[model samples]
Target: MHCLLFLRIVSALEHRYKYFRFREDAVGKPGHTPIKKWTAAIRQLAYGGATDMFDEYLHIGKSTARECLQYFCEGIREIFGEWYLWKPNPVDCHQLIDMHGSVHGFPGMLGSIDCMYWEWKNCSDAWKGMYTTGFKGKHPTMILEAVADY
Candidate 1:
């Protein structure tokens, strides 16, 4: 994790939500939950670290750590979704096509270059057969057929 970026996220969250403030508890005791700890918990979860490991290293409860991760991701999307995540315009699409053609010498290939199987964790049993490729265990799966230009 980039220390400066992590600190920025913590500061932003602290400014937006008072919960990140280091304050005294009800019994007039200083709180131990640091904004850095919350930030680390979220980062660890994003990196697929075990919940128990977070409890051991960051001193955060498993459930609380998970909640922190969820809230952090939601907060990021709510704050930065518009500018960072957006559909490409027609001009952008044309640029991608031209770039791909120049790089690979493919004229008609717009976007159909890669394929990947993704786990459908919450897929219903009724539709499993329809979605499943019948190759990867018993659970249903979905394929991501993408052709990213960048």
Candidate 2:
């Protein structure tokens, strides 16, 4: 069961990545050699491989590998949007509310909220401030707040 779930997640991620690559390609972006090579490296990592292995397999230096991974992650973020995408039906409110109540032990908690910090590299200082918030230090990042409707 766990393996099945893991495979499903990987498949979804790959599909989303491919969609983003296709969209960019359609816009007449530069050659796709980098994206293609990085995609294969990511697949190797997903299946089980070290960063060094990826570097050797792709013939990329450490710094280049880092940049490529960052590009891929950013691409995924761009296509997925900065927030959760969910469709809420008016007829399903009651059921959603009941489920939330049961799970969260609150009448209207709906969903959950969380935050994460990602390292900022190759970004200007001025832009870093806009991305950082709360107690976190300066870092080029994005804030993603999501909630369920009940």
Candidate 3:
């Protein structure tokens, strides 16, 4: 996600859900930040990253990671579902086709393939030349080829 969008999500979720809010412990030690919990949740949801990975990087527990994921999904639905989840009407389709044609010279095209940078961590020597993301500043990056919401 873009930085602004990610921060917007973090801010919205934090305001809407108490679980995403930053808190202080009884000893007055600062607890996890909103970014930390949201990062753990988005990493798992978007990259399929392991929950244990956040334990070391984000200092979040496995159970908390799962909880974050659940609440993240819930918050997204509650916060953005109205504007983003509906199907496009015919007027919307016409506008999209017109816009795409003007931008890319492609008309009558509606479906879009969602592509994302995916780093290849354990690529073999022979396959190292194939994947290059540039997502983790790693050697290999793979473009995800999933058809999202189409």
Whose lDDT is greatest here? 3
Candidate No. with top TM-score: 3
Query: Which of the two, 2 or 3, has more TM-score?
Result: 3
lDDT of 2 by residue, 36-109 (tens): 44554465446443344455455655554555566566654554445544566765666777878887676755
A best-first ranking of the candidates according to their lDDT comes to: 3, 1, 2
Error of 1 at 52 (Å): 3.0
- Model 1 misplaced regions, further than 4 Å: 32-34, 104-148
Residue pairs in candidate 3 whose N, alpha carbon or C atoms collide under 3 angstroms: 131-140, 131-141, 132-141, 133-140, 133-141
Candidate no. 2 TM-score: 0.31
Structure candidate 2, residue pairs in collision:
none
Lowest lDDT sum, 10 consecutive residues, model 2, at 17-26
Q: TM-score for all predictions?
A: 0.60, 0.31, 0.64
Superpose all Cα atoms of candidate 3 onto the true structure and report the RMSD in Å to 1 decimal.
6.3
